[model samples]
Target: MKKTILILLLHSSLSWAQMQPFPLQEVKLTAGVFKNAQEVDLKYMLALNPDKLLAPYLIDSDLPLKAERYGNWESSGLDGHIGGHYLSALAMMYASTGNPEMKSRLEYMVSELARCQAKNGNGYVGGIPNGKVFWERIHKGDIDGSTFGLNNTWVPLYNIHKLFAGLRDAYQIAGNQEAKNILIGLGDWFLELIKPLSNEQVQQVLRTEHGGMNEVFADLYIITNESKYLAAAQRLSHQSILKPLLAKEDKLTGLHANTQIPKVIGFEKIAKLTNNADWSGAAQYFWQNVTQTRSVAFGGNSFREHFNPIDDFNKMLVSNQGPETCNSFNMLRLSMALFLDKNDVSYLDFYERTLYNHILSSQHPEKGGFVYFTPIRPNHYRVYSQPETSMWCCVGSGLENHTKYGELIYSHTHNDVFVNLFIPSELNWQEKGIQIIQNTNFPYINTTELVMKLPKNQSFSLNIRYPKWAESAKVTVNGKIQKINKKPSEYISLDRKWRNGDKISIEFGMKTRLEYLPDGSNWAAFVRGPIVLAAKTSTEDLRGLFADDSRMGHETKGKLFPINKAYALVDESGNYLSKLKPIDNLNFTLDSLHLQPFFDLHDARYQMYFQTFTKEEYEKQKDIQKQTEEALMALEARTVDKINCGEQQPEVDHNYIGEQSNSGYDEEQFWRNTRSFISYQLLNKDQRGTYIEISSLDDFKTENLEITINGISIEVFSNNSKTIRLKLPKAEQISLKIRVMSNYTTPRFTEIRIISNE
Candidate 1:
């Protein structure tokens, strides 16, 4: 008996269900695809030395450290971040697995963090480098911030939000009462610190990435039932980002992908709690645009950590850095929030697809390593993060990803249960006195069986999801066929009295199909019942298969195969997906190439999108591809190091600094220049380069340009030549600082490369 309520939501009248999910503790994953992933993740978590993870927090508290800090991002400015992520992972694992060891770990982490907060006295705990000084400046209304920096500090607010989220998870998921107190105190401290800031100043500070600060504040309100926390959440929402989103415009191109997803998640969370339908609609619009236009076939978005233009996938196809793992992690969260509000199976469909392909495939099957990017570039590989050596953001999210599969497998209300994913797991409905066990091999085997254990005869509803990819499906009760016609992407609901020992079986018709890019490109991905399939290319030159502690360790710095060499499907008369011949067990073969589930087709170069062309198209494209590759290869052969301007990590790693300068995306290209000046430190390591090659947009706004290498000015021509090469004066050190300047406006410089003397 459900009643509907109408809400005026963002240019539409909508009605939604009051559906909510069962607690994570109530859902237990016992066996199958998720369990294996969980075990691997647990082993990796235990392998990490907790003392090292806690070092930064201890240091910030003016306390003695137990161990040296972990390297990479951990030892760098963004310390203590992995520690925060670790706490959440432990809490989720404890709740899902009933693992006493995980519970103990959670307790230990919370206690340590609590001690730090107690020492601070004002209830602040963090590992951001010189975080106290930065916040003090902010408290004094002396804020100087940018998209990635605050008062010359690296994302201090973002770093602290990790602590906020961890503490919240510790209390909400693991029931750590002490964690709740610390979290609330910290929240209060934040309120006091920002009480003096004007809304404009707050927005200025929020120019940097602050991961889900608003969402965590709303969660605090939920836990404490305090209106002040909700108000605080509203104050924390960045208006600049939210304003465009609320207006239902797409201003997301060129923005950092993961940085924006969390903010929108906060918007949706606040909307649900306060019934702010406009904000909810904004979040919905963002999700639709990203998943539909920006995202690739694996349900992941972004290239090289930034959103490439929707109309062009050239950057996505050429770069070894593709859709990041952390972006998909947050997208799943956004999807879950929307699904609960409207009870939409489409959201669940996306959740299932991304979970299976991206999140499930993020970790190595045997090594227990985590992947940063799943490159769609043909013949390009991926780098995996080792437990001790890598502390990249993806590693932090990867630790939590596998531990929480039980979260969306099954959800329930007071009288109805919804089995969302066909993973083998169990649900403990303690309130209703029922225990249910689901057993299935899932995508490999199209059948699933559910058995119920009840103390007595019970009346409730069982809603099983019928995925959008299923061609046909059937259900039976205790071996008796229950004839019910249901369409794709709808739920098959059975409402009746059920006694103990009742059994239910479901069988789905699995079929293969082709998914194309949103831009209507010739490239296409193969999908069999929502599982993305890939063909193994060659394993040669799989450099950096496992990441090191270097600044750029997460990237796969191997040679990119020329696009002209890619295998093409020449069949123009029919659909290539249907033409594939089936092999054994979710495996297929097309034109001598064997394809298997992407999650299983790792450890080697693989192709997710096979180039398909008609006879005429193939002939025309082949020569053009070869010509372009030859020119690109010629430039690459003599390059010692290169930087792509306006990209975050590359610029930061190269020590970029500027004033009166701006960067943006235009015509599918990212460029950086300045009204005053902009600069970067280009490495000429091994003394290999005597020339600095700068490529800019053909359009120039200024007649005269000033350029310098290592503080020495060089004469430059003010012409329309897109590529300019300047000879480097003799230098002993391997690094040189290069600056480009204009009195009024500078040309849009795209790439800066240090070329070899040869």
Candidate 2:
């Protein structure tokens, strides 16, 4: 058994790496269309002060720190997370651009982190608040783990995992030998921290959001070729999420979207390394479920960071918090993993769609700000994060997102080089002494020309991706038309002995199409090939266009325009795309509305999806929408603060605390109730609020429910039998607690709101 395991580990690293696409360092993005965005992202990366980001590390190391910690989440408990992400971003940017500044930044961060680890006098290194004590508690089996917080610490595992990933990237991508040493030490520390805990206890700790600790462990195993790291990776796997996935079950609905994506990426990595078909199949199933059923046209899913029902997207259409940038960031990682595993063009198709629509569109093109959410709520705008102000998860992912655009453009396996995306870039295959330069206007011109420069005559196969969106294509080798035979979403292979200055160009025209919501709703988004087209609405009242250093800075506090006010595409035959008029440079015109690429529409109110109806159907729906919008707007006007019960992040953000409580969703409604007691701190920004409204699907006649505000009981009487409103004795900020004192289970609490009297 020992010999077999040893041989497997020795061979696993080689086989596992072959299964991966070419490293970002090997493929260099040239000066082209993507260069500007890359430069802007570089500016954003360099603009952030590393000293402030490294403060928590300095404090942890007992070293003197000069800069105050950045505000928002950076000052909050999730400290040093940005520093971790900065390491990865700097490493990747340095590799991609060969920039001295980026290399210096990466080196500085690694040195500071090493100093911190050395000062600790243990292998452990993290910026979690009193992180040593926190790990000590978990080491002693004194764990109180929740989905968001563990041992009363705010996602300490998740926070630490960022550093783990950063160090790995630093060693693997940036070729820093010292980083490898530091990373191994930290990995050893983690192993010892959990050495005393039983498997059951380790699983208990895994219940919290750990941000792909297993993935990093698997990566560590690959790096060191050691069995202990692989065993630790297995021990760290979250069974609750993994078991159902292994059985090919879709148990992802109503869960935090970003939390699960990284875990699945890890699962796929482990699967490839161990040749575990079940694990591989589980990751494949998850990818299909998310991309096909859950994700919107922009290739993003979830509402306010939590997945809603797959069969229903009504919440997505109404909520200002739409798809999170972090989710797409992780999804792209998973997509790239799957693509490498099977060489599947389908994964690349989704990857291209998401890369252009969500990831590229996430950043502020000129000002270099990162966006957390890309709201699909008709005319709702998005908030951009400044370097010092916003330390949100999206900000961390956003930093790394733009730095690695050269990653998937071209992937090679031995002698075969695969052209995946249409992005203008260059690749240097030093092993083969070959340099490939691909240039194109892309979606504007629909043609990309690849010029290969080889040191000598080289025998290699060039595989060009025939994307799912291309209707027909023409291939030319050195200006001579070649016999082309390939289907949509398949790669066209050209195997030959290639010499220097060989030019191959592909011309494939894009067609306009309309994609409906996953739930089969009437609302639809337009697509030109992989690019999503959006209509520019009024830019009025775009509050927080740039985010401030506030707790909820990432959220766009702008007014939401009613969905009914959005222009509808009135086409009974569903041939709306056929009637569209093409403007210049990937722009189109439909029904007096000029539509452009969603990625190009920035800092303005835009509509990604439009409700489609025939002339006759529109007349019938118009009156109903108007009536519904009026009521909703009136209620929103009075709402001071609101809580969507059963949702994880919102409840946590609202400072939710409970005993003997559980949460679930049913019939498109999420509810939270407790046999003992549950409470949320509701904010009354002003003392003008006169009442508290609690909406539940409870029958008050059958169940005895007691509700209180700050230890004072409030009388609840049903006025219309649908909702019960408690007239507040005084309007002030208070914790509202609901207790089921009787034997019956408390009714499902759907919503709790503080409303100001008109």
lDDT of 2 by residue, 1-758 (tens): 00111125445533322534677877877665467788999999989998899999888778889787787787668898998999999999998988999999888889988999999988888888888888888999987655666755678889999999999999999998889999999999999999999999998888778999999999999899888999888888889899999988888887878889999999988887788879989999999999999999999999978887878898889999999999999999999998877757789889999999999999999988999988889988889999878899989999999899998898876567889987778888877787999988887789999999888998877989998999888999888888877898887888899989999999997788889999988989999888899988878998899999977888988887888888888888867777678887589888777799998899899988988888899999999999998999999999988898877567766777776566676666778777777778877876767788888776553247778887899887544464778867665677888887777677788888888978
Per-residue lDDT for 576-672 in model 1, tens only?
A: 6666889965899887789999988778999889778878888999999999989887778788888888777777677677655566777677787
Give the Cα error of residue 43 in candidate 2, in Å: 0.6
Instruction: Give the poorly placed runs of model 2, Cα more than 4 Å off.
Output: 1-10, 13-20, 674-679, 697-724, 727-732, 737-748
Clashing pairs in 2: none
Candidate 1 C-alpha RMSD relative to the actual structure: 3.0
Cα error, residue 144 of model 1, in Å, equals: 3.1
lDDT of each: 0.84, 0.85
Stretches > 4 Å off in candidate 1: 1-17, 675-677, 698-723, 729-745
TM-score of 1: 0.95
lDDT of 2 at 617: 93
